[model samples]
Structures are given as C-alpha cells and as structure tokens.
Target: MVPGLPLKNTQASTGDTFEAAVLAGLSRRPRAIPAKFLYDAQGSALFDAICELPEYYLTRTEITILRDRAPEIAALAGPGRQLIEFGSGSSVKTRLLLDSLEAVAAYVPIDISGEHLEATSRRLRADYPALAIVPVCADYTDLPMLPWLPGSSGAAKLGFFPGSTIGNLDPDEALAFLRNARRLLGPGGALVLGADLKKDPGMLHAAYNDSAGVTAAFSLNLLARMNRELGASFDLEGFAHEAFYNPAAGRIEIYIRSLRPQSVRIAGQRFFFDAGERVHTEYSYKYDLADMDALAVPAGFVRTQTWTDPGRLFSVNYFVAT
Candidate 1:
C-alpha cells in the first residue's frame, strides 16, 4: 500500500484531451496508439493482474535483483537523496529501494493515473511516516519541474525509472526523456533504471500472451476506455488481442486486430476497419547493456553499474550524470 497524504496534484489532460489524442492516433496511416493512453483505472487494474501472471517474468525477475542488490545500488548512489520514480504504478517494487536507502529525504512518485496514485500514496504514507511522500498526478514524461518537497533542499537527486518502462517510448522519445532526466537530476545526481534484456523469442512471446487472458483483457480495456471517455462506439468483442516478438525490431509488438469488418465513431468521427486490420497498441523494446550505455553517453550520463539475474531475463542499470 502507498503511504502518506496526497501531494498537490500535478496538472494533466482532461477527458476532451483523450478525444483529440484518439482522433490523431487513429488518423495515422498505420493506426498506432501511444501506450500511455492504456492506463485508465480499469486498464491499470488489469495490468496489475498481468504482472502476476506466471508467464510474465519481468516483475518477478526484476524483484529478485532489487531484493538482493538494492543495498549495493543505494551505497553507490550515496545518502540523503530525494528519490523520484517515474511510472510508479502501485509502487510495490519501490519498497525494496526505500528499505535499502540510508537517508532518503523524500519520495516523489509520478504516474499517469491520478485516482490510482492517490490510493497508492495513502497506503505508502501509513507505512513510512518519517519519509516525505509527495505523489504527483501527472505524466512524468512531459513534466518540466517537480513539485515542492517539504524539506528537499541539500539532498542529492536520485532518479528511479524502473519497470523497463523506457522501452515503451520510441528511441528518439527515449533519448529526449534521458536528456530530461539528466536535467532533472542535475550534476552529481544519478539514475537507476530497469531494462528488459534481449532473450529467446519464445520467452518474450509467452510473457505477452499468457494463458489466463489477463493481457488480452488489459489490451482490450483501451477500447473500453475510449468508449467511456471519448464517446467511441467500439464493440470490444469484435477485436482480438495479438502479441508476438518481432526479431527484426527486437521488440514485442502488441495489437488489437479487428476480427470482422467494422466501423467505429469517436467524437463524431468515423473509422472503418477491415477484417484483421490492427490497431497497434504497444511495443516493448528489448535492449542490450551496450545499447543502453550508448544511449546514456549522449544524454550526459555515464554508465556506472548494471546487474542482471542469473537467468539474464532483465537488468538493473545505474548511471551518474556527467
């Protein structure tokens, strides 16, 4: 559970904003949707279920690494740091780091879902009373400045972007985000990030297409949200979940393909879908340690250390601002 009271909510888009974004994404030639939009309350809950699925090794593998190596990660990161975590859903994994860090001044957890963040933050505050908990309800990607921390001055800035979420952004967008984090952390600050490593295609495919169908429900929730918020006329049953590893791209491509010919409307605009036409939803890009290091250099960070599990399914990397 999240501890502490809610921080001043950071500004985010309104319901109408969802309408415009849907219009734009659907207007594209290939019809792609940003992964960010799939985190509405229902979608977020389904994702939590997806994490627990047996085939999804990401959460379990990464947790084992943090459970064992967090103390080492914190020692190199040093003390009296203000921890800022991006995409901190549920914040369950954050407990490992919070426990290991010596003297964290405050914890600022940023997420896209305002309602979800509030509940998580409330419970977290109960657990760690001495720690300042500032939950910002905003998309961390576009955030220009962080909210005020009650006693945040004089602490080293420690940025945490875990969950291999950096893979969600396109390479250019990821670079921009890296640069932004460098600026946010400033000199002498450091960042710890989790990345999914390139593995056998079979493992990757199974992780996305679990037997219990939670992932399918999670993918389909996007349509449920669109219909609710944007007045979209999408028949959720008409679509089927499709996720597969793309060797050429070194990523897992997830799409919701139309099972039959259909038409849908959102905010008065209509879109026609042919049988088997796909609405591309997400891409989980896999990376090697060297590829990550190459990205860090141009973003003003120097790769410090990286730890991988025995099975080598995932990695936790630490980088310092140069």
Candidate 2:
C-alpha cells in the first residue's frame, strides 16, 4: 500500500486537467481522453494485465529488443553513469537494462506515484544489492532539478524513457519534452527511448482492444478512479471502452462511449450525456524512424542508433546531444 500518502484522496494535476478538458471536448464531438490519466492506482494494475495479453505485443516486443541489445547498449554507454527512468512503473522491463549496464553507479526512478516509486525502488535495491537506488517521488515532466554528482566532473547522465510513453504527447509537446530533457541532462548525456511504429490497423486495433478485456478494464478504470478521488457519481456500466487505430492520423484513439443517457456529478458539477455519446480518452501517436528523428533533431539531440524487433512493432532509439 502507499504509505504516508492518501491514495484515496490523491489526484494528479495532468489527469485532473485533462479529464475536465476531455469532458468539455466531448460536448463538441465523440472524443478520446488522454492516456496519462490511466495511470491511477487501479488503471495501473489493469495495464499490468494488458501487458500479458497475447494481442498486446508492444510490451513483449520492446522487452525482447531490450534484452537482445542491452549488452551492446550498456557497453556503448560505458560505466559509472546515472540511469534515470521516466515513468518507472513496476520496473518490469527495467531489470534488463539494470542487469546489462554493469557500469552503472546509481539508479534513479521517477514517477508521479510516490508509493509505487518507493516500493519499486526498495525492491530493486533489495534485488540488486550492488546498485544505489535513488527514487524520486515526482512527475516525470516536472522532476526537480537533479544535483550534480559527487566526485564527477560533469560525467554523462543517461535518460531511460521506455514503453512508448512518448506516443502520449502530440508532436510539439513531444519536441518540447525532448528539449526539457536536454536541459536537465546537459551535454554529453544520452537518451534511450522506446516508440511504437506505424503498423496495420488490424494489429493496432487488436493491441488496444484485446480479447481478454484487460484493455477495456484499463480504460474504464479511469472512471472508477474519478469516482473514488473526485466525488464522481459515474455509472461504470453506462460507459463502454472503444479503441481504434486511425491509419491516416498514425495514432490509436481510445474512448469511453456512453451506453445510455445519463447524468453524473463530479467535483460539484453535473454532466449529462445522451446515449451513444463518448468522451475522448487517449491518443497514442505512432512514429516512423524519420518522425522520431524529427522529434529529437530540433531539441538539440542527434539520433545515435535505433533497434527494432523482428516485426518492427517497436523501436528502441538512442540519442545524444548534438
């Protein structure tokens, strides 16, 4: 359980703002909510289940690539550097990197979930007794400025951002995020990024709308979160998960469609919806190799290398300051 923090009353700034914006956006048309909100405690658990679904190939494919290339990545990255992971949820795929990077001096995992971070960090420290685990309880986007390392004359710091989470942001936002990271990492640092590549609509659709219903449950968990945290009276059965890949947009759009006319109150406001209405929940933008370069180029970084799985379902890209 989350200690010292009230998970029952906890709320995320981005998730809260995005939810209201999405609710308003739905008034104009059927829409999807941002995927970030799905990280609440319950949503996070459901996503863990999604990773096990056969149709959800993203996690497995990325893990395979990481395992296959971790040695090479570790060798090229050298030793005694800080390994900071953004959105370090569960640290499921992170073990590969930690195990491969024998030269790492310290491991820093940052996330919005203080409870989750502390728990994962504690477990990692226990499992990897040799590693120094410095867990930071904060949002990845606004992580506090890091202190300079002791006895190091500006050594390179590596940034590990896996799980295709970059797809959560739009192009400009992605670029800005890269810039922000550049500022935090300074020169000579590197960024290892994972991204989903554009693929067939059938595969994309199946990945987000798995047969096991894990994805649907993950999508709906956001409502349950709101009900618990924001005093929301949402009828979970009145909303259904809907997901599809837009080929032209090169994105996956996930939404919760209303099953019947309903009225719900959240944060003291009443929201009414007609049958068949929907709220935009998430847009996961896919990227090609070139598009990934475009995102990093203007942010003062140059793509160093990219590793792809056999099916090209996912990419692990390495970038360095230009």
Candidate 3:
C-alpha cells in the first residue's frame, strides 16, 4: 500500500536506519543515538509538551519574531514561491508564514517521523484546504532530490527551517546541510532559518531541563521506544536525564545517565553501563549573529537579513542561495 503523492514515506531508507541503530550503532564506546531517532510518534508528542513549559523560551521567542515580521520575511522569500520546511514538527510556527505568504504556491514539509508528519499535514490540509500540502517522510540532512511539484516550477523556492534545528547539527554537519540546501533550492531559492542566541548558561540549562519534567520524559521516551521497537531491555527507571551547557563547546548537551550498574540488551546484543555512565542524546549549539552569518557564507548562502524578538533570545535569518 504505497501512499501516493501528498503523503509519502521512504520505507527503504527508514528500514536501513533501524538496522544500523539496532545492529552496531547501539554498541559503541559511549552509546549515542542520533537526535532524529528521538522523534518517533510518542517522542514527538512529548516534545510538543516540552515547548509549552514556562522554562522553554526558545519556541515562544521565535514565534514572536515571526509574528511581528512575517510580511517582511515573506517579501524576502518572494511571492508565488513554494515553502519547503525541514524538520517541520507540529508546524505551529508555519501557520504564520503560510498566512503571510499570499502567493505561496504549495507547502512541502519534510520530517523523519512518518506518522507524525502525516498527522500534521492532515491538520494543515483542513486549515488551508485551498493549498497543496506535500508531506515527505525523509531525513533532511541527506535529502533525496526534490521532485518538481505542481505550481512550484517557475516560482522561487523558499526553504523554511525554523526551530533552531540547525543548532542540533555541529558546525560541520550544519554547513554540509546548508550547502546541500543550496543545491536543492537552486540559485533563486531563499532560506528562512531560526537560530537560538547564546545567552545566560542558567537560561540555557533551564530550557533543556524544564521543571515540568516534559524534557525528561522526552529523553526517556527514546529508551521506551528502543524497548518497544528494537526488542531492547531497558528499565526506564534505571536511567536519569541530565542536560547542561558546555560553554567551551558553545552547546547544550543532553544525556541519559545510568543510576547504577546495569546492562541492557538491544537486538540480542548486551551493553553494560557503570554507575553514573551516560549515553549522549543530543547537542544544541547556540550561535551569535556573526558566527551564524559566517556559517552561511561558506555554504554558498548570503545572509541578507535577520529578525529578532525584543529580548534578543532568538533570531530568524533570511539567507539567499547563491
């Protein structure tokens, strides 16, 4: 039952992804799983909850920037363009852009979580019935060449990567993604990106380690997911979530630390953890304006403009592919 057109999932690639995660990747010196794996249906829902917590300022700050400057952002994106969003979770902020981009031809959202992506796309369809909603379930980092979408050919392509997701990638991977985006969007394309600014370490720590425990649940969901999907034996109670800022690295790192000496078996392979041992889950690198602008130049993009909230906690940058 192949899902046609508007709802498509790259099954082969996703299967390979699972194989890698279960067979070899899980049994590493310091076990780590790519953050993409953390967004299965349940994980995605938990993250949505995390965004609503009072401690999480990143989501609201970026939304404010978009709400206030949408027209200006839309103008730079140009009219009659296709809006292709990478890692378009929930698409909560996407509505602002969609409402402002009067001549937008179509909306293409790419996400790794197939079920969650489809659900979000369905909701968007109901709200924006007149618009074409193309949802693709695929990795944004290594995107397959985009097909020529209807009503999208002649119009400029506008790449929307909000959520400061670029921060999740290290500098090298982020540059590579931007460069690949350069090729995907072609010379006439523009990218609207959100980046979290470097701020007080306390604020950074609080954002990831929210008081409501949603962030912790999101981290633990990864383990629960492994137990369900990979046939792993992980005691959800045996590990604790920890997130903190690494000033030297300019990133916030999240880990699941073992509470005591423990062993878990995934796909029939055993891995042991000493007390206090941790498996790295995610890294979110904060960026200042200058550092972020420099990242674009090497990737063949020109940082034409930026919009930020009054608090300056976040930035939405407009980059033109050259």
Candidate closest to the true structure, highest lDDT = 1
Q: List the residue pairs that clash in candidate 2.
A: 31-280, 32-280, 32-281, 33-280, 33-281, 33-282, 34-281
lDDT of 2 by residue, 1-322 (tens): 1112112212346456646854665455544555666786667677778888999899999999999999988887888677878888889888998888766766677776666667776778778876656676555765547543444435578899998989988788788888888887777788999999998889898999888888888888888888887778999989999988888879998888899999998777777888988787778899999999888999988998999987888999999877
- Give the alpha carbon lDDT tens digit for every residue of 198-254 in model 1: 999999999999999999999999999998888889999999999999899888999
lDDT of every predicted structure (CA atoms): 0.88, 0.79, 0.87
What C-alpha lDDT does candidate 1 achieve relative to the native structure? 0.88
Give TM-scores for every candidate, taking all chains together and pairing residue i with residue i.
0.97, 0.89, 0.96
Error of 3 at 59 (Å): 0.4
> What is the model-wide C-alpha lDDT for candidate 2?
0.79
lDDT per residue as tens, model 3, 1-322? 0122477675576746865774565577777888888999999999998888899999989998999999998777767888889999999999999999977788889999999999998898888877877888889998867766764577778999999999999999999999999898886999999999999999999999888788999999988988888788999999999999999999999999899999888776788889999888889999998988789999999999988888889999999988
